[model samples]
Target chain A: MSDFLFKRMTLIGIGLLGSSIALAARQKGLVEHIAIHTRSQATLARAEELSLGDSYHKDVADSVKDADLVIVCTPVGACEAVAKAIAPYLAEGAIVTDVGSVKASIIRQMQPYLPKTVHFIPGHPIAGTEQSGPDSGFAELFINRWCILTPPEGTDAAAVDKLAQFWTVLGSNVETMDANHHDHVLAITSHLPHLIAYNIVGTASDLEMVTNSEVIKYSAGGFRDSTRLAASDPTMWRDVFLHNKEATLEMLGRFTEDLTALQRAIRWGDGDTLYELFSRTRSIRRSIIDAGQEVDASDFGRHIVEGGETRAEQLKSDDHKDTGS
Target chain B: MSDFLFKRMTLIGIGLLGSSIALAARQKGLVEHIAIHTRSQATLARAEELSLGDSYHKDVADSVKDADLVIVCTPVGACEAVAKAIAPYLAEGAIVTDVGSVKASIIRQMQPYLPKTVHFIPGHPIAGTEQSGPDSGFAELFINRWCILTPPEGTDAAAVDKLAQFWTVLGSNVETMDANHHDHVLAITSHLPHLIAYNIVGTASDLEMVTNSEVIKYSAGGFRDSTRLAASDPTMWRDVFLHNKEATLEMLGRFTEDLTALQRAIRWGDGDTLYELFSRTRSIRRSIIDAGQEVDASDFGRHIVEGGETRAEQLKSDDHKDTGS
Candidate 1:
């Protein structure tokens, strides 16, 4: 009879993910009430200022007391402590989930503390911008993005479906997979890319021959792309690499090995190898565009967004005018 | 009394840069007449269809005949052949320049064949999208972008000034530097970032553990940023790496060294080192935005372009509405 998925939803951390979930859930009327709790009192105060929740609590236990759904939105490293703090307070039959990048480690960190009365499903919404904090979140951040849920074996089907429906209404395409597979997949798709981006930005800044001003001024030439990822939250990314160590290192190793081969090709003037690899990689982006994961516009559509017209749009208009000519 | 920068301007290749120069020059009325030439007749025909130039030539020498300015816009590898082809036909006292990524190599490849009667100034505009070819250009591509000109010393200062004025009128801030210095600056800013992007995309696609579809579907995490750069023209990138071997290799070495250290930090669970580097790199992107090299909007303003409202704009509107509430 009730349209609400949960009578009360408790968000344990009020960072980008937590605040976004708050804004999205409230905007969609998916929950009757949101009880917010954060380790930092300042963040809690900020959440209240933004009206991100119906009730704000400095005590984690107080926040989860009557919640039928509890979401931990913290750095992967903080999962254990959050689970330990909120475990005794979570209502019977409540659904417990997280929005961490790594799934297996999250399960390992929180599983021991969580009571068997609640259905524990770990989820990672594969969505974010480089910016972080409560002020940086929005209701539409998850629109058309993928939210991957990794529930342990024998979890209640109804609970999982309810969570999936909740995310669906929040404007995400949800996929359920094994915890380990989610980690492995994300290690390549997200973690490795962030690592490489941060690494390259660090290298560019430390260069003595090229001044930092030069690097920043001419960043439009490919380097600025990496800077977006490199500008991600240090604390969150640090926890990601540390928690997802095995898979991150595995993908990173492959990346470095491929990079070494590319270096050799550049050194030996092997245009064929460079051309072959470069050509092959171009199609992957096209596939990403076709798959609806990336915008098809050139330069991520920055020019269109800034200038009000892309070259493709201009060409289309030009063709129309040429018909009369 | 005429306002034209040149009576006739010849473009030696009709790709992204060449076609863009033609469009921008024509739109700005910088030149009286434009001559376009390319090795591929198909591309030449495309340029003609687009009305990119007043004249189209299948023969490179014919394109340069009676031209007061010649811009070779082919891949750096073809600079030598282009120089040799246009040398005899180039008008006396003409300004010969190139839009190559690598300056020193462009000079080496082009200066020998260019006659003393011409002023050879090598220029690189730090502006482009991933798209290529005649259709992928627009008149506004050079606006607010930096164009570096590396004119050899002891050349006619007036000629260099004339060329600088041309770029200035084309909506570029022109800076003059030595060819070697130009190579070093671009090596870090453009070449290295591209190589890393191409390398990582290759690594992601070749992984046996992760399917290509998974990478494509979930690329919004971070990998999609790299794909934009990886989707660039292979022939042009190959020529860039091959032409700027020394500086590219040097930057690659530094990047690898830094990456290895970051890897060690991750491997050893050294969160401080990771945190420090990640936090420091965040400021560089901000500086780039401040310097007008990158869009200040989150996610490169993709959401604003697509949805017509960014989160920041939404927050501002929300604040105004909350004043009375």
Candidate 2:
């Protein structure tokens, strides 16, 4: 949102992704007018008091009446309902998009509800954190990350390009792919890793030997990394699995097979095989760092807490003492 | 090592852990003289060049003569060989110990070679990075980590107490457990994590659908964390598995079963199960942060590149283009 990409931009969720889009839009002057909407009145009030938008509404239909652009930023499960709620009031020729993680499901759910006049493009900014809520976002969240657009077979090329430009303004590198490929890629890169983190942390925490204090004290770098992934918003992740079930199951199958091979290697005392696998994996990390997608410092995770610290200030605002920041 | 814990110390193999022990011992003035010996003459020369020890020797027996404390820091496979190399020359009142990860294996391998007159204790300072060789050693590596000591039933209490004090001085909290239990806990806590990391990275790297570059570019926090664990030293980890085979196999069993359960949850769209697992894991991370082992922040894995930036200066040395920073 480096300039006025849209005169009136409407964010139809006002959660972490939506609030972040609003923040980045305002900071970069991408939009002249911002309309924030959420189903909860308390959340809408919280967003308003925090100056998240120039206009606020509890109903999606009320908020997107004349919006030049409407960005859906709710959980995938809620996207279809919100789309249905807002479609009747959507301005003709309005560009509609979302920031959901799973493209296929969100598109499958929301596209049918929107008017054919509105460009219903599905895009996912490959960026986020474990923390959620309106206050837990920043303008730089999408910086240097990928914003992938998974448009259906008959998507309007002009509309998709316009949406891509919008993400580009937010400092994201854009890529175009079919919804299925996008889902498959994300399953391996994002969803599976998250499941592993959540699974291992759950397992370790439940262990009698590695109690809360012991695991906490002994976590070191590797375990700490897993915790961050594991700490992600539970509701968001649950919806992701529910919506993107097929791709996730496929990725899980592959992961289980790989893990089983490794278990056998260890059981059989295959030292050379273990060494080779361990060595190869190290190279992938180096490649990631070289590709500029990752950092080599220990404090990448610390930035989340720092961002959250800034967000905790929202607690001081009377409007959001209980609702949100 | 504070206030001269020993007059002379002997290290049988000067690899990462051995060299780290030397550095930590010297940094705290734990020993007046450090006698370094390794089977590899080149390693001994490198240690001398780094000034890691007061004296360096190719022969383990020649190095340990008259030393008050003898520490074998070779791979577990080399323990018996190194013990026999230094056995005939060990002083009657000298203390002999090792920093091997597996206590039972090391005890079985080395105890027979040493004289009963000397106090023999088996210890593993639960520390280290993926890097290896003498140059990778640092004084702070053991700080805030656990050092599990598995002394035998009839081991001298005074000797064990003194070694515990030594580890405490090195900034490691001393935790004594039976050899079997220590191996089991570590198997679950460290070994299994590393194995999983290696396997996942290997799987991703080998994927036909995903290019390595794509995986590298979109890695995010989850993948980077796994890579860090995967990047751990191959030889050392190989030795650990070979030595601690049974415990590792047992832990692997639990992990595999748990992972299969998670896979099923994801496949069936079991939101409640996924949420519970994700929620429980989240708390473990928070606890880890409370324990000062992790930074409770977003994208903790993103720091890897920032580390590389500082390493950019170090990388100046990589091309043999040392500009002498």
Candidate 3:
């Protein structure tokens, strides 16, 4: 009897998520063979260099041929085209899934094109760093992180469990929810936060009174935290906002309303109101830390890295990484 | 002949910044004696227990008597009262400074009460974590950080240089700028970011469609980053918004305007606009990292800590910290 979850597993894109899944699946020995595919030859070559899969395919259909599992790891906007291209080649009883931030739209875009013979489970591993591309992948990226699966209603239960088991082996805590509800939950938790980070960084850059240098110099005060999220992959975030329009806008509306009220309190010098809101928001951070969703260290443990090395030493190390003229 | 910068140094509040200053100054051997005071006897006792200072005083006036350096580390809202209490006792030629977030307001609040015999330099060290209080301070807190000193015009340049040297010895890069200009810079860099963070956390917690538990569970997606800033001291942040009202409101208006445009882009599915804004903001983070204002690691290096231990192991360690029933 085979111990592997599947005899063949194919990845349809080779970016941060795709490469990470490849590394993680192999590290856990979850699949017997892994096939990687991407339209960009540069990425495909890089994945091959990284040895992220057992085989690399430039053609999307060839990548999934006879594969028992196919995971599409493209930007949400490209999911429909990928679904169409790989739909015909997927083996019978194959579990097809895509890792997209917006699940409802992913279902809307990919579900119709997928064959009825295969199980379609839309999943989002709520795990990533600001860095992108093949080199950014690491097997430990999913450890202790949440991977949400939004399998469509009436989907095969056994197939859903199989996919969940795969994510579980990769060290993720799996949860299943209605696709629309997942969209709403993620809108407030993920999309709105990224939108706000990008918007603030733009505002700080464009300010006439405060030069960008000054902003950068003093960013440790608070602004640097926003920059981490703002530095995420532009194409991916753009696709997320476009695909998750309704929930994103709804959450953004609420955020703006709350901000307006806070603005009024600041302008009117309502110290009590400001104090109340600021005080209440603090507990949520404690709750997150308690829930093990956040690092318990202050400033996300940046100080540990910083305190380990002096500024001059850090600069010298960074200079070594820079290209010499 | 002594190597110490000052024969006596006094801190008027024993909070995060105050305690950090005590630790850093002592660590650098810049002060021969450190005197600490706070209105709260509990905090003063706590500081004494921590041995953060050479002497502890219950009376603010007594703390500054014979002190050549007095730094009022109280909230900006309490600066006027602290200045009034300590002015009569501050030694002649003593350089009085503050670590308030709002420079102009600190000047307005404390300058009038200070005697001309002493130099009043309003300073803000642009570094902190979300945690506050006496226990939340470290000697390395000011290392590689920028400390802005806003000394009023015609004040003795010698005294300004002396204070600047003091901060530099404590591992800070000190910059002298006009008080109002410092306020404007910090309004954009620090105050507005905190406001937005506090606002977003508030919005997330109040969502009717999304449970707070769900928000906490999946916060690793992006929302968790904002929580760090929102977790900062409520009393300190309240005073910052109240004291830095004009510049903060101006920056808040700009931020809101920019965010509104981004909101419109999302609503209209303007992918190009979103992509452009997202792509451009990434460079700011890179600049900050280059400037040594932020950690260069991805996700602020949270992964390093997480990858060091499995979730179950981390939970076990955390349980050890909890009080046993």
Candidate 4:
């Protein structure tokens, strides 16, 4: 795995995902020379301070020049400008990819601007934290996470393989799916969840009956979990909704319809409907845990117990102590 | 704290909350004897096996006999019946309280049945995990969490203080507020968040274009967090929504209106509106962390780190190595 290497790798943004790529690539020795570019000079300086890349460039063209792999890590709205800026500077036969949340729009945005000689593979690592900036990234950010690649039909198979291998070396399991299917899947899994979280937190904040302080204090009751997704980068999520409008809106429509039905059930005291839905959703959480997407923790595993006992172990200890008594 | 003692404490339902009270009371020596009773024989057997109380009774009358303190830990919908059954058996001057989420509704349902000789305090502990069972009980479940007590006007202050002291010894911070206000606060803080979680997961599960496996696989992108709340006990949540109908419906209405506004923003490509709401929600997460309700861990502290280093420590180590390099 250590033999996997690229002569030069370019990243176009230095936010959480971008800096994470830099850190993971560096730690894994996937790229010998890393070139970084960001639109903001302050961010570029921050990346330079963190030494996230071997070289820092103010211009996207300069960053991609002679690079074997160029990963555009900007917000989805900026995909076209970045693609156009680096199109001429990209080396022949270089692999051009992205880490954007939306795949279809990214392909539509960058396909026309990119050179025919380059292998344009759009990829998204289904991983992130709420924090942003170069300082927030770690080498292990992508460990055991999924990275989906959406290469257009008739694209070079060898190019797709190379990009998949790159993500593999960075500790992500790679899968390839059609761009449209990827958009729909992500709309339900990522975009819709984030939108609901942001909306709920916003709704709670605007409540005249519940003070902001009370909301914060009693957040562990459940509201705080939604806040994690709501706290994501506003610019990135805004672009995601804008670029993936059709799919996002479709999912949001379904969500709103379901929510309305649930509202009626609550209003009508239809406990059976609420209970059935709640019971069914519980299995989904179990499936997620079994599928290795979520940790099998009780209450997000926040117990400060010594010896690092897991929730299950803690429960067992309670039973043991009770029986002993 | 060790001096605090109730001669006999009766727990009417030996589920998650009932068993937890038994464990915590015993752990802190807050009660000399605990009498446990549950209508379901299976649950009662399980509670008795766990030694959750000093004595287990098949009948509610037997359990509450001569009990100086009686805590009803049944679902909100069952409060009136449990109050009725125990009213005949409660010792004079007994401090009778409940752990129902909807305080106003519980007060309404139980106030008439509970004798004036017994001080009835309707209360809610703003703490729980998705898991619920007799086996899930632990002494530390309430540590640093808020417990709200809503006693009727002219109720015995001494009894209320005694109950508060009991909860304080069991590791909770107690506050007294009006029953209606408690219902309103809980509707936003707990009930509505849960309903939204259950609704979104239900929506995702019923998606025509996306398969259930796909939603489960890519859930780490954000969907999995919501599933935690959705995985909570169905029976408990059904009662919560039914008992807290007015406040729950009010909050749900606001949520739907805000969600509609957000949907319109997404449809019209209103980036500023999306960004503003997203930014405002981010600070609430920070406030939750600052208020000690949630950790500052990225992704609700659900990282699967093998080396036992926390996410923050791992990020720091990356920076340390980078600067050293």
What CAPRI grade goes to candidate 3?
A: acceptable
Q: How would the candidate models be sorted by DockQ, starting from the highest?
A: 1, 4, 3, 2
Show the lowest summed lDDT stretch of 10 residues, model 3 chain B: B316-325
- Chain A only: give the TM-score of model 4: 0.93
For model 4, report DockQ.
0.51
Top candidate by TM-score? 1
Model 1: per-residue Cα lDDT over A1-325, one tens digit each: 8888899999988887898999999989999999999888777888899899999998999999989999999888999999998899889999999999999999999999999999999999999888777887888889989999999999999999999999999999999999989899999899999998999899999999999999998888889999989988888999999999999989989998999998999889899999999888888888887777776577887887667445644532112211100
Mind giving the per-residue lDDT tens digits that candidate 3 earns over A140-211? 888889999998989999999999999999999999999999999999999999999999999999988889
Top candidate when judged by DockQ against the true structure: 1
Give interface RMSD, every candidate, in order. Answer: 5.5, 13.4, 11.0, 5.0
Q: For model 1, how does the per-residue alpha-carbon lDDT over B132-169 read when each residue is reduced to its tens digit?
A: 88888888889889999998988889999999999999
Off by over 4 Å in 3: A309-325, B309-325
User: What ranges in model 1 sit over 4 Å off?
Assistant: A308-325, B308-325
Q: What lDDT score goes with residue A127 in model 1?
A: 92
| Share of reference contacts found in each model | 0.68, 0.51, 0.72, 0.66
lDDT tens digits by residue: candidate 3, B1-325 = 8999999999988777898899889989999999998888878888899899999999889999999999988888999999888889889999999999998888888888899999998899998877677766778888889999988899899999999999999889999999889889989889999999999999999989999999999999999999989988889999999998999989988998998898898888788999999889988988898898877667777776555423222221111110100
| Counted clashes in each candidate structure | 0, 16, 0, 0
How well does chain B match by TM-score in each candidate? 0.96, 0.89, 0.94, 0.94
